[model samples]
Target: MWRRFTTVVGRVIPGAGSRCRKRGWVTPVTVVILGLSFLWTGTLADSNTPRQSVLRVLAWPGYADDDWVQAFEKRFHAKVEVTIVDSDEALWAQMHSAVPPPFDVLAANTAEIARYAQAGMLSPLDLTKIPNRRWQQPFFQRLSDIRGLVNAGHAYAIPFTWSSMGLIYDRKQFAVAPSSMRVMWDPRYRGKVLDFNSAQHNFSFAALALGYPDPFHLTPGQMRDVARELVNLRRNLLTYYTLPEEATALFVQHHAALMFGNYGTQQVEQLRKAGVDVGYVMPDEGALAWLDCWAITRNASNLDLAHQWLDYMQEPEIGKQLTQREGLANTMMPVPGGASDAGPKLVWLQLVENIGQREALWQRIESGDRLRTFPQ
Candidate 1:
């Protein structure tokens, strides 16, 4: 059951930050939870303190894998209920709306956190209850050092996995596929290209191509320039798939020449098992970096159990399982003694939070107005 759950949550793979843009989806009341059992049917909490058996979590497909819930319940002696978010927008709507804090914790990326904190939807860290907080990493330390980090100037969330966006491709097809973002738009491979699942990714990739240092810092003119280019690519695109696994599948089935994927090497291997040939590369300009964290939601009924669950996950053994099951990298620990480097890119992406530019760029891309890359 847990493996089945992982399979679903694994789809989100990696993307987004702390607060997801709410413009995308109009959330439904009945959140579809994976890895669900009788775990959340009843309330199991200690009267003296907050003891919760059922935990409501809004996560992408595989974040609530049954294995995780079963392990957590067995170790902490509690039940957890998970809701699989349909899209990034939907998960964030749950965070900002008048909706109650349905889940005890969120396995969301860091970029999305700032939005949640600003909306007064998220709470500060109750670090005392969690043991993982004690095993902090230096990389995380530097991130927190940045002045005025979202949640009340304190990190309410704990970093779990870390990755940057890079290219994963097929070796058999491109004996010499360059890491440059231009390859996706190259006319020689025109209709064979597939792009990243998000607008930020789309525009940022173009920004890099246009020689911009930061995608988020683009001026209006630069944005328009990139938008036109995106629109053109959309026209030539085979399909715009959001799932990491799906991106990999495009290559496995020979439906696409290249895809915008940063991690999930397991898919590459799986494709190989089925006789698909592929490889991954990070372009010279670079890719985006992402951090997935575990945070407690305000009003979460089983806060204490959630903290315990976090502690259990921080344990190397459990963290290892998470990394193995999902292709994303974790911040809790360094890559084990011997691990492959087929993760995402090395450069941190300039995340776009501005709604106006974001929408315009995506619209232009979808409209096929200016994109033209495959220099013939």
Candidate 2:
């Protein structure tokens, strides 16, 4: 039995030609529907029934599709149960819901991989089994060079897809591309800027715009300063958005002039498809990027099968399909005119000093917390 949990939500943002509604604090709600279970039946005697290996997969929406899972099941004669998660908080909760963890494998960013590795929830990979990794670009081949991926001399995850959180501007709003992240804070664009509704990325990028040397690790004073800066950003935002589609809708409907491209190129593609003339640029302070990878659980029921799943994702054809379908940059090949290729600079995501602290403060800020409430 293959079960998939999916989230379906109505178009929350108004249409492009709709009247601009008064800007206020908007919290998007996600409705999760239990999709019908797919049962594969075959002719067999009850006594001769064969046990099919079950591979439980936890991934982001676009990472795992029905066609891909169906192909894997057909090739290996296994049952794949996929679970989709929209946020890191939900992913962490699902992983910890069971003793051995509910899923056999998961797709997470480098920072989340480090967090899982520290908790001993992930198993080290045997690169020998994933031979297709050789087809990856030179930058991805050297795993050790990337932080949060290799710990204690063991590789915990394999690179899959990545993009930098750069700046997205409406071409009609700006004669030249915005060169700095500070553009989002410009008073001229007040109530016309869109920012991702993420605690970690918001704090990290705020630090970058403030000329902080290290974004992941911040001093107590630095944290307070970043929080205050975010308060200023809140005043300029039309509203915070959670998904790329939502951001696109808000951008078009509100006639937004600028946005922090949290989804990076993926958001850019979505906006373009929506008939918006948008240009993406990496700010001078550098963009915070995320590299999503596949990692096997520490207590995987089928170790070989989990490894095969990782290898399957690395196949050149599979990578191409993912890129074409999702507008994501796959590791197997170079992205044509991609931001990561010969860009300003990319600060690969790393484990932050204190995720708990960031989240608590972000909650307050996003809820319309006043500037005086923040630390000095």
Candidate 3:
């Protein structure tokens, strides 16, 4: 067993959105989510051996809190080490790093899990080891129905959380909710818009605004069109933000008229807690949404422990806690009348046509490139 321990430190921001931040850490550290004290400290060189049966996890900021981690550790009689990541790019980098995969299990979106499984970095799950699947709602239990969870007669990921990226606007600014995503580019809201700084979602949102039938699978010609649209969007945006907290700060500081809320209701809860009355609208073309799942790593040192972690997360109480504490919807059961499910039409995320093309175009847009660079 790999016996390595590092300290993961973070600050206690005021609301739910505060957990999402651009992670800046010197070295890999494992945070023991005990009382879940949000402490901020610079990188510390504390080299100590972890106790036996360490189950390292890679998850989003709010996914692995103290309550769940502590309970999981107690139930499984293992030491839990969590690594918080802000973006799918971070998850990719950590898993594909030169070092052996540092995490035993990871929570990622359906698209990402597919990419990882394609790369042969994920392990086929032993369903018999995870008894909690029976307790999940039918939507989650039937992996065969979900497009990306099962591949070639093998289960690779377990459904966990799901939400969407909707158009969020200041209720005070608009007496009525903006009915279309095009409102963000209305020139009226120019310099008052905040957009997510993600290559995949940005491209898809632009396609949606352009009325493309398949936003995720844009043609090369459509790609160029989307790129041009994004450039126009860049001109309107005060700035691009990666994390929900940053978006919240920008919205309040700049008095932003609108934003593309990537975290869905979590962002709404955060903004409300921060004293902002915002309205979330699914644009006429529908909004981009995602289903995040948990998967065991191919390099997991303790495969059984990893399965136990998945089972623990599927428990109804744990799912409820996730919704209550983090404002995200879990798949353990249907979200019955909650902000998590109250949104515009959700266009579930699909595998993109070409991530490389999107990233290249996104870089140009971010660098202030002219629209003429796109294929005319």
Candidate 4:
């Protein structure tokens, strides 16, 4: 029998300083000068027509695979349609548009769950309807206890998958494993590193590696420092990547020595399956861990059916399938074989002070702009 899911509890408190502040961390003048650009305008394919008796899902790549979806549809006697997303910004745009949201159920991280809950785009889950949650680890059952799963006495999301963003390196390059995050910036790895293209995560990781006290809340001076740090990283990087598959192809073709693992072990699995000799490590600076959950939309046409999907996913067999096929850690059961969740210290994601500012700064960095280009 498989062990119970790991009950690692590190939920941050609400109304804490770490939550995104109402006033921007930096001066409004500074944000205005940066001229933030909101570029996520991609539309879902065939979202116009409403499917009859279908359970529409919007989730990340592996969450709604054909194998498990077919299983769920067969079990519930309902047709399943999925829309995949690469980022939280994209997920927000989809649900925010349709009142009875275009999709009934979707997966999102804690920070995003908080945002959607605040926007009133998500629905409170009826735990009584999801009895399978009894099989979930205690940490997950106490949804209100988690940092972002509950708001104003309502359960907004169900913890489903969890993993840490760590370093993935080429094993052939180093017989002994490296222990520090600095390897990504080492001079020896010049033009051999692949970095994620996201503004929020890159800035946070840079802050972590630089020993910043709080990676999520950077002062203007710290922001400038992180910006310069990323510019240096850009000089050494072969290219920045977004999707896991894209990273895999780049790693193989470019012979990348180091990469910031965004999809966590999922990326590691993909690379290994492609026959690449690579190793993953959580550096001394610690790794950022993201917990993604399944949530219902406020306008879901089939509320009961949506709850069934969440309940079914929490099953041991389905959770096992998630790990074996997608290379993702499932919250419904312990990591197979009594593996410990202990590793690099796990930094639970929190609301940033100013995501717009980070996005603006990131656009500049990606465009190859010098740090001096933006006004101080």
Candidate 5:
């Protein structure tokens, strides 16, 4: 369950064109479809004393691999059982709905944690039993720091891997390289662009185009303005959704121009090697970042083992390995120190529950009240 880091590269600012940034507040109905909260109620972790059996976990694709599972078993004399979830939101419904939540450990992200905490569906972390706790970077010192926008700061959650959200594009698409954000909406590139279907990413992209703050603090009007811009993006778009595998295929085989790339540089390298001329740009507007961490359920079956796993993950050796192998940029993968960014704590605001304050912004986008972009 470890990933690697290649190198640090630079980022560019993107563009906004035509009537994109000039419209009404997006309505809330569409939000319903995309706004399900993550509810993790499983018993992957059970027992306070050492156990001989395996621990069950509902995590993402990478965590379920055999080699990773075997390694943990060998180290602690306990086996690991894992399940793969389609989305963070899906994991949420499964945990909260079932009584005695079947899984003990749930792979979680920053935004999802805050919602779970608010809902009272989680348990506090006990650091005393976990041996791997000492290795964590200062970033995960407290749940609030790693979870950031997600409010379950203390008593719940431990950091695992983290990264920023930004643009991934085909390299051969442009000659001189369009580094600025403005190029994304160029009339010439119409119909060649592919956008992520996520509201957070979409609105964040628009907010950046408007010279708004990074991890934008959307006001009633600012958020509305962002929704207007994305709806208009419907006209010139080739693909208006988020699919990593599909994006890869579209870029290489179908000539798509761009899509939201999570994690970081690896996405760019993957496309380039697959015979697509792909690349990524961080953008001057900065971008939404995230940490996919591990958390214990309120009624975990194996409290001791879960705590042990939490500490194990913190060890620099284990954490670094996961980051490099999984292509996840945990809390330690940043600029070596407490490096600074230009705006509001990009570190702190990475995860946002845009459901409340940004409701109007999302509504207009869903109803197409201000949209006019891409192919109609």
Candidate 6:
């Protein structure tokens, strides 16, 4: 919910590396030889030769499409290599697989952006280069208002798309929309509920339902309590789903009455297209929302091109196309009946206190670990 490109070896300057290690500095004779090699190998090519810049993009499935990428390439006279990632774990693995990240730019949620920024994997953006950001809504334009985009007085990400994880209930089954997250736990919906198979969100939402002050940063006791709550939810769940398409199929097949809309409105739109009359709502405990943004890598090959790509995404028409095609809300415009619609509070995602702990415990809970084994 995310490219193949030939690796281009960077040209090494004669004394660039040696400058840091003076003891192994290149000799004058060696520098002269290297200079000639550059000329002989055509490293300094003719000025008239047309050169196309390559920009590798790592993004979610709907974020980078063939047609949209083609348009960006044509406009900038560059080549875009696209790679799609379906989950956060995979995205992190790919980003760290290489010494200098393989991609020039990537799209990631705010929490991931914070993690990458903290790890020094991302480059601070030059806002001046991205003129199109002015088109973004006020809520998005204020980088400080949104956590995880700025660090140490520098902004590292530009908002792209966002949505909330809410509840989706079968319209025919319920006369009115559910008002709280507790509805999923009601015995009436037991064996008829579908939940997304995600450790982080499951724990966060469970904390929310239990009325934790900060869902992202739970104490040791709170984590144990939340884990127990998830164990209870497991009993109510018809089954866990990894993808929206899979959830849609399970919902229709099992005649499921409720589902944790992990993909938010995107799932709603999909279910509707499949002829399912579903109603979505953010429970009284507030829904967890994600704001995905574009950020250039610290080792970006071409900063100008990367900035151009970010600016291009912020363009009104491109944003409109993204919303219309993917059913996601773009920062450039407000989408009616979108996650920001009236009545439901949205809790923007934040870097959690301990992701490893959440994943480990969630694995045990999801694998049928006994509730009695959990700490009281």
TM-score top scorer? 2
Ranked candidates, highest lDDT first: 2, 6, 3, 4, 1, 5
Question: Could you give me the TM-score of model 1 versus the true structure?
Answer: 0.76
Per-residue accuracy of model 6 over 1-376 as CA lDDT, tens digit each? 0132223122223223432222221111111000000113335657897977888888876787767887887799887777665567657877987888788999999999999999999999999999998998877888876789999999999999988889999999999999899998999887899887678889999899999979999999999899999888766777776556657777887789999988898888888888999999988999988889999999999999999999998999888988787678888666334434323488878899999999899778767778899889
lDDT of 3 at 353: 89
Clashing pairs in 3: none
Local distance difference test values of all predictions, in order: 0.59, 0.82, 0.77, 0.76, 0.57, 0.79
For residues 1-376, write the lDDT of model 1, one tens digit per residue. 2222222333333222222222231111223234445522346445796653676666664555676777777876766666665435556655655657556777766656655666666667666676665555555534464222344456667767666566666666687967697787778776676665466667777888777877767777787777767765654466665545555555555446676764445445445565766676668876655566677777777667767766665666666666676655655566432222224334443236475567555654453443353121
**Candidates 3 and 4: which is better by TM-score?**
3
Candidate 5 C-alpha error for residue 305, in Å: 1.9
Listed per candidate, the RMSD to the true structure in angstroms reads 7.5, 3.7, 6.5, 12.0, 9.7, 13.7
Residue 321 accuracy (lDDT) in model 6 = 84
Cα lDDT of model 5 by residue, 1-376, tens digit: 2231222112111222122222232111111011111222554545675646546676754544455565667787776656555344446656765787777787777667767767776778765776465555655654443433334235577767755666776666767655556667777777777665455556666777778765445765776566666766765566533334445655555477766665444455457667776666666656556666788877777788877766766667666566555565655555334523313323333445465545455544544553444223
In terms of TM-score, how similar is model 4 to the real structure? 0.82
Model 6 regions lying over 4 Å from their true place? 1-51, 334-344
RMSD of 4: 12.0
- For residues 255-344, write the lDDT of model 4, one tens digit per residue: 888999989999999999989999998888888878899999888889999999989888888788889987888886664322233343
Relative to the true structure, candidate 6 reaches a TM of: 0.82
lDDT (tens digit, per residue) of candidate 2 on 167-229: 999999998888999988899898899888778889999999999999999999999999999
After TM-score superposition, the amount by which residue 157's alpha carbon in candidate 1 deviates from its true location, in angstroms, is 1.2
